[model samples]
Target: MDIRNRLKTTRRNLLGLAAGAAALAIVPFAAQAEDGVLKGKNLAYIAFGLQYEYQVTLVNRVKELAAEKGMSISVYDGKGDPSTQTTQLLDVVSKQPDIILLNPVDAKLLQGGVRKANESGIPLFMLENLPPEGEWVAYNTFDDVAGGAAGADAIAKLIGGKGLVLEVRGAIGSGQSEKRYKGFHDQVAAKYPDIKVETLKAEWTADNAHTLVLDAFTRDPNVAGIWAHNDEMIRGVVSALRQINRLKLAGEEGHVPTVGFDGTPLGLERIREGTQDADVGQNPFSMAESIVGEMENHFAGKPVAKETLIQPVMIWKENVDSPDNWGNRVN
Candidate 1:
């Protein structure tokens, strides 16, 4: 058999063996059991980085929910390194936790680890990221395309639909990054003929974004606006703009009306301070809640979605402090 068919057959066989060994716990809905509280189960949460405020926020929500539901969890930090993440995934698989939650640093590096988890019958969940080319119980997150499109629209509106806009994107191969960029770029090109969008890769970190921002400012000093794929990179952009003495508020005459995604607390705070124009908000709490809920339901023989797409929210300076925003809940 060819590779695709071989993978399918191997997965099927592995799942069959897993189902026989762990029963409905692996097959999901194969047993006639009622749903109950998630207790005594071990969950592993692996994030790309915790240093970033949003990721720390995401991990905190997961920890809180898992604790409330009576499940014990271990959090592993990838530290923005794919090799480190690969090692962490291997360690998680070795532990064979009841459930695994992964926000991968690199999809390719995690395929083997995902396969190992599948073969061992441990349910795996992906949060705030697309599933790798392997097995996953489900992927729970917002529509990055919507977020990007909304941000682009906001940017177009802010800049009068015509100007040179720089795009600060996440890691080179990030699924979310690619989707966000495409959606934003497509909308800008389609609806705003006069607007020009340029891009740079930041690897979802502030440091890379900071360096790129400096270079971009030197070459494109009159850049009408800038859009970062996430709030983390926005912070870097803001810092760089401030260093060059070019930062301005949305209404200010010299302002560039920078736009950001993620609506993180820092981003929202910047918006209020006029360092940023607007942001698209996503719920990390909802992402974590879905992961826990789905895992519990699947184990209880209850129905659950294979994929859940949460809607995105657009946040302007006026609503930065609204209770509905994830930033408001941040400590």
Candidate 2:
């Protein structure tokens, strides 16, 4: 071929390559534009209750991230009542916000509200607890069942796999509470057959837990360890033990090894103080990140997962101070 023809062919190939590179660079910017569409959108978060530390932290983190994205959020507390949550859900559905985040106080009772949201075609995201029937954009929550099993294992190991252990349960009919109860019992029966667990319903309140634990101890002072559904209940358990003169530090005589779920700052503090032995840690911060990210993905026309379960971590005094723990990150 002639030299002129060869030069022309090389120039055309270079131009094509340059054009391809430029197009590749613009792709990310285009995606950024899509992601930024969340700005000015409205979100309604219906929390189970704000009284508990874990729920408070989760809701606060969601609000913080939503604010950073320039989104407006309205929060409603269910106050641990199914009726209240149902009312709030219906009201929020009527308003038809861009997105609805629901942490149901009772999943069964909220089915009607969920169905209404579905019929209304509003995007609904579930947190912690999922309604029995609903079409959700995504459900982001911790593995409470696994967390319960971890607590079982901790308590069993502490008591040498054979002893009486008291279980401070959350509210009856709560999905998370039921799962934790089932997980704890299933694990104990399957893996630690010698352990005996007596349950007391506390309704996820500190006062109830304190009273129940105190009464249980009075009836059977031979209890070796205790497992509570949440850190808040553990707080009551600690107070009860202290009142009964049974609150002993780890490695001390007569010390009742206590295990709890929810990696709240208070739980981590108790672990450091040696009163609480172990905690099944759930990363609410990560849950918040997932919630916000899923919202963005939905707005950006991306596919959202049906469910995302954040794994639970077992935290002991040995690793309670790790900054990776959400409890440690909270100010």
Candidate 3:
């Protein structure tokens, strides 16, 4: 049997990809935290990089929620360095905050930190971005494979299922990078045989993505669509297009349609302007709220779910401005 036949991307499968983050779970049962663990309590959010727009958005949301609760989570920026994140995680663990929210820079590299958090008796929440899968205290995630598949399907449809598609992937060795690319390529190889995709590493940086796109198109201008793993990379792709004077809106004679993940306000606006075609909206805001809400539940001696699954939302120009349809804030 052809391997591709066995590996098919179904609507149902693609729709629920994020469920796997905590899906096959036997989360170790633990006693909930004591009362008043949330309000006025110190919660440390160890972020991978504050420079990322998505990370910035997460921090901003934390602030908004914190102000209302009369408490704030101490935010630590890893600056995209795995070692820094590991160091920060240990430092945060030493303080023994009421709860810890970790966005691991690199799951494997942060194992030591994970072990420390696990040993600290403090509740650790992996919101949206999951760590190397095993037993987690609590986790909430977007359907990443589903998100990637959605972008693939959109690009396929936009290019009429026939053309060269350049995949601008994120940092290698990361779970998301692998899963997102897998979902996309698997769908393309299975569902849209006529569509051909070429990949280049961007390391999830805009500069690298910008150069990668420019270089790819420079080598092959016949490319029809681009699938960026994140919206920041999409910005780089846009820059490349603008420089080559090939930047055109959707419906223009020869605009190379593109799709991206991460529903940042800027990204959504680009979609609204018809520069970017579609976005697989990862609901990090909701993911954050869901995971953190567990603090209160735990304080009440209630069992928090092992995993909270938030489905991916696909945004295009048609519904970009609809307040209710947003994955993140519109503004």
For lDDT, the strongest prediction is 2
Q: In angstroms, how far off is 298's CA in candidate 2?
A: 1.3
**Model 2 score (lDDT):** 0.83
* Candidate 1 deviant stretches above 4 angstroms: 1-37
Q: Which stretches of candidate 3 lie over 4 Å from their true place?
A: 1-37, 133-135, 325-331
Cα error, candidate 1, residue 245 (Å): 1.5
Cα lDDT tens digits, model 1, 1-331, are 4433533453354344323323212222211223345776778777867656566667777776766667767777777677888888898899888888898866766788888888998888887665447778878877988888998899998889998899999887777888899889888878999998879888888788999989988987879888999887886787788789887776787987888888776677777777788988888788878877898788888987889988889899778889999877854
Model 1 lDDT-worst window of ten: 24-33
Off by over 4 Å in 2: 1-35
Steric collisions counted per model: 0, 0, 1
* lDDT, residue 69, model 2: 81
In the order shown, what is each candidate's alpha-carbon RMSD? 12.8, 17.3, 11.0
Tens digits of per-residue lDDT for model 2, 1-331? 4433543453354344334323322231111122376887878888887667677767767776876787777778777899999999999999988889999988999999999999999999998888767789999988888888888999999999999999999999998899899889989999998899999999998899999999999899999899999987887898898899998888898899899999877788778778789999998788989988999889999988879999889999999999988877755
The digit string of per-residue lDDT tens for model 3 on 185-213 reads 88888899888889989988878988998
Scored against the true structure, residue 312 in model 2 reaches a CA lDDT of: 86
The candidate scoring highest on TM-score is 2
Clash pairs, model 3 backbone: 18-143
Higher lDDT: candidate 1 or 3? Answer: 1
